[model samples]
Target chain A: MNAMTDRIAGVLVLPQPYVLFLGDTTVPGFAKTAFGLRDWAADKCVGELRLPGATVTTGLEALTAAEAHARGARALVIGVANLGGVIPANWRASLVEALEAGLDLIAGMHMRLADIPELAEAAHRLGRQLIDVRVPPPQIPVGTGRKRSGKRLLTVGTDCALGKKYTALALARAFERRGIDSDFRASGQTGIMIAGGGIAMDAVVSDFEAGAAELLSPDAAPGHWDIIEGQGALTHPAYAAVSLGLLHGSQPDVFVVCHEPGRTEMLGTAGYKLTSVEEIVELTLLLGRRTNPAIRCGGFAFNTSALGEAAATELMARESARLGLPVADPVRGGPAFDVLVDSCLA
Target chain B: MNAMTDRIAGVLVLPQPYVLFLGDTTVPGFAKTAFGLRDWAADKCVGELRLPGATVTTGLEALTAAEAHARGARALVIGVANLGGVIPANWRASLVEALEAGLDLIAGMHMRLADIPELAEAAHRLGRQLIDVRVPPPQIPVGTGRKRSGKRLLTVGTDCALGKKYTALALARAFERRGIDSDFRASGQTGIMIAGGGIAMDAVVSDFEAGAAELLSPDAAPGHWDIIEGQGALTHPAYAAVSLGLLHGSQPDVFVVCHEPGRTEMLGTAGYKLTSVEEIVELTLLLGRRTNPAIRCGGFAFNTSALGEAAATELMARESARLGLPVADPVRGGPAFDVLVDSCLA
Candidate 1:
């Protein structure tokens, strides 16, 4: 995909410029993963097919399968990797209808759509492809654990779906302006599509997770470093392992811990409380030093989406004091990148 | 291997028992992994061949290749997965000589000896076997993200090799006396050999790390719980990822924090200071809750090897007070397991 309109770009909106989200992504928890996938490309979403009793964002209309087809939608993407992320029968019926309507299916849940024979058969008969973003690359390397000269900065997080990718992307963009020389090493599908040069780390077999990290951190150009996108939190229950491999394999010189300012509970866990910024910074160090003692906590980047500008600023100020490191909202114009590059790459 | 005369059983007293450690494992940093492996089997070691001036534990003699052979050495194990854990040429020569000596070779480093054609050829010509403890199981599943019952109590640590396995083992043994019903789920070679079942978490492909955790946490048998040996620290420079996967995959109901008393600096990281007990515990919760929100820090277990008994005791008391959790060394009798069970399982 071209850099201008990456995969998330298309996923956010379909080729026919009309899309239907199979599941209502309006729930606070279930919508975290898939809802964020296309928020940047919201215009393509014509409406969502709600599974009654679910509320979603107001951007899309609630449409039935017939209504979605009558409206000219091209694909049916599972918009929520819900509480267990399994494609259940209720959802299956909707997916089956979508497939029979000849709509392509795109999903990023732990469960693959093709795993269900009925869905695979329906998609096959319908002449539409089922895309599983978590699929690993055809080839992956065994990690050499060799150290390199170029600096690597990875964005870790307090929990899953907490803007790690956004922080890394912001760093990449900031680096571009500063001419500090860097590459955004994508660790997920949204990233891979955006950067056009990364592997979906989760799809890779566990043994090669670190290897994928290693491969992603290319030998530096004469004046370049790699700003690798961090995956799940090292503490994330569902995806910590994936994040761990990225941390070790990347061997980053410094890491930035991403946090959601108003997120008191971890996304997937039933209701685990969030820890303070100071503690997270230290905990991250405990994990980072395993591979590289020189690794440092560059700073913190808050996902300030839930807060007003002033409130986010106040929270960040408190966090900065707590961790004694640079902190900012990487999403908006801020100092996180400056602090990240200066302190880390300095 | 027989439980009574396991591999470690022989390494502790090997000249009469016969042993040959291929590389120098005397340095404080490089020795942690290998030294721990056979320190329990020291009497079996004839001598560890050195790279001229490379010192080893006082227990093992620094013997020449022929001297070790004359001493009836039967196996050639790479004593150290030294700096970067790579197989360097300096150590390769000794491996070749050991093969010619008709000794079996065992390695636990990131580098597999079998990957080296010349080394494999030498072993083949010598009729000696090559054993890689870290080799992952043949097949690992992508996690179902399903929640499980039967208390999964995983041991996490401030750093690697700080006694996570020891803690798990201690819990297992303690549970045995109390008839509490539990399995010592091994995650590393030492734990594997000790428990007689487990996959080397690191050896498996990255995607399967969590899968390994799932498999290790077998369908709970009736009322029995699973006390899984944890691997690598969440903040380890090189190994946080491995630890992350183990934490997420195990889906423990409660976790015990492992620490190395008086270890101001992390093992491999140059000059990187360790974090506080409170931070590690909190960080672990952040990761654990992603899978199980109720995942609590059961207690703290200290590796106390670097400090005097009294100093270690003082350290534990202070840490316990600071974190409001019971703390003790798992090796010697203490309240860690009790605190662990009461706080977590209750």
Candidate 2:
């Protein structure tokens, strides 16, 4: 039987009232239900974890590590909904013991993992064995039987809350109205497909990288290409193990990115800082070049409401000329962005 | 010297780093030189206070009550910056004694106040007044030599982070481009104006009426009219107080409100019983109505990106019909939004 030793300092005994468990079959079945329901439950669960004056711990304590392995339970899923404010040091120890006892971690919400160094250390000790579970980006689920024949377009953005989803949805609606086939999928969500199981792999890998980076060099900037790439490589094994668990049923053709003008300047939030409109256009070109060199990039769309349309249009034109790609201003009263995208794909 | 009685609890301290003393000099030179660096340094000389952590206290011992007072402090120039978390309770008694012993309550970032029920009772026994400082809604700053002539437009969102600031900035830029002058201000910054010496009396009266309704009957469906009137009134006291400070410098013409969609649904971070979108919209419209009636209502601007142009247009139209005021959809592609507002305002 697993024993609680004094070495485990942050032994947070979750109030019995809040602890919940779903059997293996039952859990997967619930996830298979409506996507909105799944997302809603996931968001609710995360919210519960964020409540103040509550301590939560998840793992198989009664069974030995060997027994857990026999039952196909390689890791414990520690769900952290929020990581704001001060986290006690004792809690850190419990987290370490849980991971050492073969528990993996999954955090929901925008968490500052760097704030907790102990968790990172525990993750490093576990190496490639740990897994992070996050929501799958809003993409067309597999087996829906939707087929794409015309230019299958996909749009991405520089960061969350930068009007990426709205722009993508708008583009999709615009394309559908025009009878052009298109798909919407975020890069993190796509990474899940690449990681195997139906589970979204990008968020997990992102976490692993963040954890490892914090342990190794806490000061290193997060969401940076180098850190992200390293985390992806390190978590590849866990991802492969769960490959069957994560499956991407659909794919898109042309990928378009909603470019935020001042992304580069904002370090931890989006990844880079944005100095000028030219920088946003250039960043899009660079992303296309680095991610998929052969895929012809369909122009850039700016959040004109945030950045003036005139300024955005001027910058796009300058960047398009320099990069040899078509640019479109999706802002109302300006040229139709959808028309430009369709023409480019054609 | 004042002696510490055992009745003190936690203290809520408001530390002001700088204070600009405005004497009887209207001359720019005298205003600038009167409050030499020494006057500002006086804040640091104020000794720290110790208070209890449990229960509510009154007078100097009651931190929350004291803070409520400082929030409405007039005839004094104090600025708070870089405050650490609230002070612990242990220091409350000592701090209170110090304050009573001729230690002027100069502002600093780490002011401590106590919150013990016993201390509150003691203050009551002594007949020390406990007044709830009224806070106001957002308004533009005065003395920048800018005036609102044609219209004083303000954009607010149904929820925070709903792209209100971006949209407002966009509209401002658009108006500037079209040779139509406008002023831009954030609500939070405007709320701070009260400390800078503005008093909006009309807004305060409205908030009082609304606060009374809320206190009288607390129910789920308190009706839109009541809630909106309350919010307008509640926010008005603070808004008016700040505006009073600003009016001492300049004036503006019409006031515009960039309508935010929902309130309770988005404002409350924690999970609560779900409320329908219709209910939220109703409440928002009510708030708009009450606020518009009280102020020189200019026009309305909707956040069309989240709530599509169609829904936003419909909502604006309904508001116009109900209040007989003009509304604008600054968002490009919004149907009949701009035209309606322009025509109505003209």
- Which candidate gets the maximum TM-score versus the true structure? 1
**Share of real contacts kept by model 2?**
0.00
Q: Pick the candidate with the highest lDDT.
A: 1
The total of clashing pairs for model 2 equals 80
Error of 2 at A163 (Å): 16
Candidate 1 C-alpha lDDT tens digits along B173-218: 7777787888878788755533444677876555557666877786
lDDT of 1 at A27: 60
Where does candidate 2 stray beyond 4 Å? Answer: A1-29, A32-75, A78-104, A107-346, B1-186, B189-346
Fnat for every candidate: 0.42, 0.00
fnat, candidate 1?
0.42
Badly placed stretches (over 4 Å) of model 1 are A1-183, A188-238, A244-346, B1-106, B110-113, B116-130, B334-346
